[model samples]
Target: MASPSNYSSAPVSEFLLICFPNYQSWQHWLYLPLSLLFLLAMGANATLLITIRLEASLHEPMYYLLSILSLLDMVLCLTVIPKVLAIFWFDLRAISFFACFLQMYIMDCFLPMESCTFMIMAYDRYVAICHPLRYPSIITNQFVAKTSVFIVIRNAFLPAPIPILSVWLCYCGKNVIENCICANLSVSRLSCDNFTLNRIYQFVAGWTLLGSDFVLIFISYIFILRAVLKFKAERAAVKALSTCGSHFILILFFSTILLVVVLTNVARKKVPMDILILLNVLHHLIPPASNPIVYGVRTKEIKQGIQKLLRRGM
Candidate 1:
């Protein structure tokens, strides 16, 4: 433990991100796969954005929501992956204080934004299936525009205090971050001062934002399921299920991985550090990589739009 007297020394201006120190010799092997995922996330989301923009028929609320998701995924990938790759490929692990905090802020903000997006998407499906007539009125392009603004503002401002609180801590002793990213917990733990406030805020804010979104999404899906079950025609039921199946799969993937990471962290002593670190890295990369591909393969409208775009290019 660092002495109380040492806490008064100069605060750290930079942090050394020791990414996967236990597997240092073999960690370089991760570079290729992570890089590929980064490229895939960028390319696939770009394609989705272009397809949605060019296809006049796709200028609707659902596709607009998808475009928002793609935009979020793209920004997330851009923010984290490049620096991660630089660290792996060039052995550049030093992150300046401001940059580290900025990364933490963005990660904290955008993750909840993604959760809120999934909740909005669930509501969109619920309206379409449960109140088909009202959906047209309720889920208009204007409504989606407003929802987009809400998501940005809610997520941006709500989590702003996390990184800000972390910045106020005095990190005078150790500047080495164990994980690849500047996660709030990892960064704040190094502080010389009592970081109980930081930890409490992080826990309360994170669970509150994500937990509320999850509950709403669950309620929306329950209604959707009931409406689908009430369908008289077998074809109508199947069609409704097909429409929601893609979104459900994505929600499952995103939420399940997150749950596992959280549980493992709670039982940290039992779980290997390398495994936890790898899970965190994968949580960031895999969803962005898979989200577009899942929609492209499963959604008929997006598939056709991609085909049309390709044909036009050729």
Candidate 2:
């Protein structure tokens, strides 16, 4: 008989997503919740986008960033969740190579874009609260437009080679991807060819993009805290604290989930594979789900816009 490495001479045109827990009949129960999360996320984000677009009063730097965040959250949800629900509900896991690469590209690219967005939002807050007078000049319409273009270009180009590298890899062995979505490692691990480089590159690229963003955001918050503390007026200080609360809570959730994922990935041997799989799925879904509820609905202007829209409907 041929050696183990020799078994995969035929090409891999598709990958089978094994999905979480691997519970055949029981997995059907998961469809309702997953669909609900998708619906909630998409509906909320779309509503926020529409509110921002229709309201001229919301056409400012802060609301513009929120608009971008809402858009990103919607795109992020669409990229990974629908196929996942299909896999869970219908057991339709087989994804063609081109489609898989496209999914991988969107997954990799959009996440870093999310990180960039949070960082940019932090900076916007810093400028607005710390230097109110100069805020209008500093964080202008042109600045927001430029930053949006930069975020798109940076993330689109930087993580692009990752999916391309995966596409080029020869998957000669079993083509089963043991995850809900086509993640970089889950798919590359199936390659008969060694994928050591892919893992290392992804690790480095992930940390570099997300890590730097986190550090910068932390620094921005530090300055924000300092500025808030310097204000002698208690009411002003309280306003600043309240203003940052919702945004920070959402950011904290985003950061905490990502941190857990990193810790769990590093400790994969000790943790159950199913748990790891669940964490991976939740990492993509939770933040998107949290976006509209945590940030959009909580924002005063968005709530006002919603009320206005409802009144108009009446």
Candidate 3:
């Protein structure tokens, strides 16, 4: 570890976020679309949360979990996108080192928490479908409340070291970050101090959080499939699979885009930096944008609840 004097000696005070360094002319035009997406994400998620909270009919364990998901989606979008839009719209790229790490920590913690939340939801669906009789005991209100706390604490503290350790590193090099968001490696690479620990911890912590979540989610689906197949009739299997369809589709998009971002990041030398960065940014936005539309709007129960709420409004 570097000494305190080593960190204090650095002259840099803030980081300049160079968003879309490649696109010179039309990057400003990106403001409207990105802003629109952010508004839509916030609106959709906020509406879902309100609908879930106010309506007595949605006071079930599943809706509670869906509410948690919506809250996370709204948080993830709010945490990252506003700063990005600032960069695009007003050229307010200068963010304090303190703010940078704060952003890093929030994004790091919440993104993984969302991933874990998806895994938790998968298990919830599995129990609800595969073992309906035991669903009550398996996933009670108490369980969801306790598990929500665990998810936040586990994800927040597990990756806390990544940014905490990062702040200690001496950043005497260029203060310009290549990416829009305060991404871990993007900011870390600017440090003059030894960053091997940061890199190693990132790899280990990332796989531990993301890898384990993906593995368990996959296992949940496997069990779901097995349970559905053992129904002793084709129609039953279809019905079972159909019940999981919305969740499956949502998780599929979430995992696929994330996997693509990871792969492209690993093979980044062969790809355009803009594309890799776009994937990174979109990974934050797309799932949140789709959540309320897919889960709240298309979901029959949520849809009916919304219509009921609307009718009551009229």
By lDDT rank, best first, the candidates go 1, 3, 2
Which portions of model 3 miss their true places by more than 4 Å?
A: 1-10
Model 3, TM vs. native: 0.94
Q: Candidate 3 — worst ten consecutive residues by lDDT sum? A: 1-10
Q: Between the candidate structures 1 and 2, which one is better when assessed by lDDT? A: 1
Please name the candidate that would achieve the greatest lDDT relative to the true structure. 1
Kindly indicate the candidate among 1 and 3 with the higher TM-score. 1
Error of 2 at 172 (Å): 1.5
For model 1, the superposed segments whose C-alpha errors exceed 4 Å read 1-10
| Selected candidate, larger lDDT, 2 vs 3 | 3
lDDT (10s digit) by residue, model 3, range 1-314: 22112233457898888777788557778889888888988988888888887788889888888888888888889889999898888878789988999989998898899888889999998998789999999998999998899899999899999998889888875788888899999988888888999999999999999999999999999999889878988898887787778788889999899889889989989999888887888888889999888886557888888877788789
User: What local lDDT does model 1 show for residue 4?
Assistant: 17
lDDT of 1 by residue, 10-94 (tens): 6688888778968887888899999999999999999999999999989999999999999999888888888889988998888
TM per candidate comes to: 0.96, 0.95, 0.94
Residue-level lDDT tens digits of model 2 in 1-314: 12113234588877777776446557667889888978888888888788888888889888888888888888878888889898877778778988888989998999999999999999988987898899889999999999999999988988887888888888876777778888898888888788888888888888889989999999999999999999999999989887877778889999999889889889989987778887877887788888778765567877898789778879
